[model samples]
Target: MAEDMNVSKGKLQRDLGLLDAVGIGVGAVIGAGIFVVTGVAAGVAGPAFLIGLLIAGFAATCNGLSLPN
Candidate 1:
């Protein structure tokens, strides 16, 4: 694989380690969910709003994990 590359091109470097990568991905998902769903969930469910988010996340995750590869 190394031999297939053009040696004249600059090498690419990884700036994020595994922890940073996972944190970034999780942060984006949580941030988007908070922005998109927080107000509506609050108005609808009041103090128990988080249960809806948790249930939806659980269902989505289960569905995702059960899909055929």
Candidate 2:
């Protein structure tokens, strides 16, 4: 058991750099904002919120496709 634990610990590495950490933080904030906005939109729009969500998703898809490589 002790040898197995030592091997597991040695195999793990702290590999995240500054940019990776920043990207993760930004992604988390944006994800939280999306959840809050969805809740508020649902309360205000009721059943219509689903329709708006579909439209938003379609728009996002289009926007993503239009981005230059």
TM-score of each predicted structure versus truth: 0.41, 0.62
Candidate 1 local distance difference test against the native:
0.82
- Mind sharing the TM-score for model 1? 0.41
lDDT tens digits, residue span 4-67, model 1 = 7544356764478999999999999999998878788688888788887789899999998896
Which residue pairs come into collision in candidate 1?
none
Instruction: List model 2 lDDT by residue over 2-61, tens digit each.
Output: 475555544664579999999999999999999999899899999999998899899999
